[model samples]
Target: MGYRRLDKHILKAIFHRWIESQSISRIHREEGFDRKTIRSYIELFEAKGLRPGLQMPDEDLDCVLQELLPKNTRGRNKRELLAPYREELLRLVNPDASSGDPESPAERPAEVVRPKTAYLILVEKYRLEVSYETFKLYAREIGLTAQSKRAPTRLESPPGQETQIDYGTVGTLVDHHNGKARRVYAFAAKLSCSRLPFIQFTYTQNKESWMESNIAMVEFYGGVTECLLIDNLKSGVLKPDLWDPQINRGYAEFAEHYRTFIDTARVGKATDKAKIERLIPQARELFRRLKAIHPTWSLDELNRQALLWCRQEYGRAVHGTTGIAPMSLFEEQEQSLLKSLPPVRFEVPRYKPVKVHPDRFFTFEHKRYAMPENCRGQSFIARESGGILRVFDASYRLIRSYPVTEQRVCWLPGDFPKSREALMQGAYPRYLLSRARTLGPAAERLIDGI
Candidate 1:
């Protein structure tokens, strides 16, 4: 039957002989035709929205689902499946006896046992997941995700355990304080395991703000976190990764005082320290409302108002991503994490030594830069960062910094001394300004000023 010529009549005969509900492979076998002919006929029937030869199970559906949920979800789904208290919903509804104590992560306060939840413990067993919807779907299918499950994340710093930092845009509009406004970059911090968020506002997201914000965030978080996590914001981290991230030495030294490990999120990965990611959207929401009111004032005032707005509106609301209010979550998981709030919590960001020359200025592009006088005549290290110019003694102490780009700029500090030698700047001023007043009063005045 399989060798018979395939045609409409033969196909029709085969179709009638096989059951209407039979699979294509089964029908081909029963009808004595190859699967190719049967499948071709099925495709033709499907074009008209009619049943193809047979409706078959989709084996690839599982494959696609697995691919989509590959990162951490498979393990999460399995743990959720094998859990004991899988059906409980642990919402942070109203605080009763079960309501945990309020612990501010910035306090890095004393440790204590807080009121605990079934799913919070259950969630840990599954693995720390940021997306609740994704967690629940897999949990429902396999094991323990409750709709109201709380994830017990220790984002709060351990008496200086960890700091989370990022730069976010603050929306400003016409109605706002400054008639026209530019986006403000916010540097925020929170304890990693505890999750108490602190923020600072700055003019730009450049190296200055990048480091200053970290300084401010540490102060806001109540003390230095022993470890810090950040994105590859060129000003802060030159190279980014889970392992081997290159920290701007200037930023790394700042962390050293707090005895912290500086880690950066891997290229393209956002969930490395996701509690911070969850907090940033709320910052935009606050700015959106305040910017509409057109609150007018200095950058400081605007930031003050913005902070107040966040505390009032967003601080009390339950987090969209986490199942708990940020404040409440901070109080519960982070209080127990505080080690000993150190005495030295504040430090003005400082710079290191990079080298530049005296005769020819270092050019960071079209702009020329200047180093300290002491580095003069000798090969010296000059370090400039965060809107600061610091020339170092060979032993490496602060020297001097010139302000404003005048004939030079130093974008990447690493190339300072070496770049100064480039011959482009060595050329004398082209066509010295004649001043066009050789014998006149204008010439005399120019000479006097010079």
Candidate 2:
């Protein structure tokens, strides 16, 4: 007789009856399974530490059935077919093997051959008859193309200690003013301890937008984390290195203003900021659902909806990994632990390298702002914030500041030479009049009349 394939329900039934202290003969008589089969299942359960009157979870029962069932041997047959070409396959997969000298295997750098490429090579060069799917399967079985099974380390942070931030694209939105479709991106910041997330949608991922989104996230949390783990984006990290990364000037200032540390993830390594990486997909899904409902909504409206979703839907829902609602976790544990917010909100400044004109004026946002006379014909940093354009020397010391205005040119009294100031202000005539008065009354009257 062919072996019977039993479903989970039947196995559960048999296990339940046995747990009730029913005899094997009685179970076979009642359940219609063979006596030997019932005995084997009882023995298997007993070996798994399951005893009579012990409550068996569904998961435990599933494990018992999985071990008891027979595995398919289809992979073994494929492996047998691929065994003859094992050496060739290994040569192809080796990254340092030479293509021209497969037999000798010279040490030369080359791309690791993919499974499909190996399969094609076998079919074309070696005349091996096998399907691509079977070749891939056996390649993994023989460990030629097998992925590493290294388990990832679960990183944990103290409440309010760290947050991970990244940007991900969330479909396009039509601009209200230009009536053109603009690709939108979501800026996501997730607290490492509570798994609480804050998302903002923007049409840009530039330096200003990045700083603004970070500020918004910090304010949303009502505080800041001790450290921020961010991706190596050009807007935040100007140069990415494993040991030392160069952070953007604006972003570094933003971090300083918030009293936090900025840590950049390694290049091409997504696991460095794994928390935010996981949140990105979820955020993208939320935006997808929102877009489906409000296809014609403006960017501002979409952002509002995203915020609402964060609070109501995502925040309230129990997190899969944490097994607690994010909002509840934050409120109960992480909220009080966060670093206190600064007295004033951080203003995102624009940093630019500008050349000072010969007249000691530098152009900022198409408007001319006067720098110190010493700064003329030199390159300096221009920082714009709070309606003031500050010029910084090469040493990053504040040189001077001019009020930002719509006027074509802005200059302070100290920015010009005393003589030039008088000439530009039309004070030369007054000076001549004063000199004439010092000479005689007639000279003073003549200059005044003129």
Computed on alpha carbons, the lDDT of every model, listed in order, comes to 0.53, 0.81
What tens digits encode model 2's per-residue C-alpha lDDT throughout 1-450?
457677677888888998899999989888888999889888888888888998767886688777766464354675577887676666656544323453443534223455555666567565667887788777766666755443334588989899999999877777999999888899999999998989999999999999999999998999999999999999999889888898998899899998999998888888777778877866766665556446688888988988887777789999877899999999999999998888988898999999988877778889887776566699999899999888888789988887877787777866676666667667988777877888899999999999
TM-score of each: 0.45, 0.63
Candidate 1 per-residue lDDT over residues 8-98, each given as its tens digit: 4555555444426677777867777678767766564455344535443445423322332214314455444434432222112112212
Strongest candidate by TM-score: 2
Q: Which regions of candidate 2 are displaced past 4 Å? A: 1-153, 414-450
Looking at model 2, the pairs that clash are none
Instruction: Report the alpha-carbon TM-score of model 2 versus the true structure.
Output: 0.63
lDDT of 2 at 20: 93
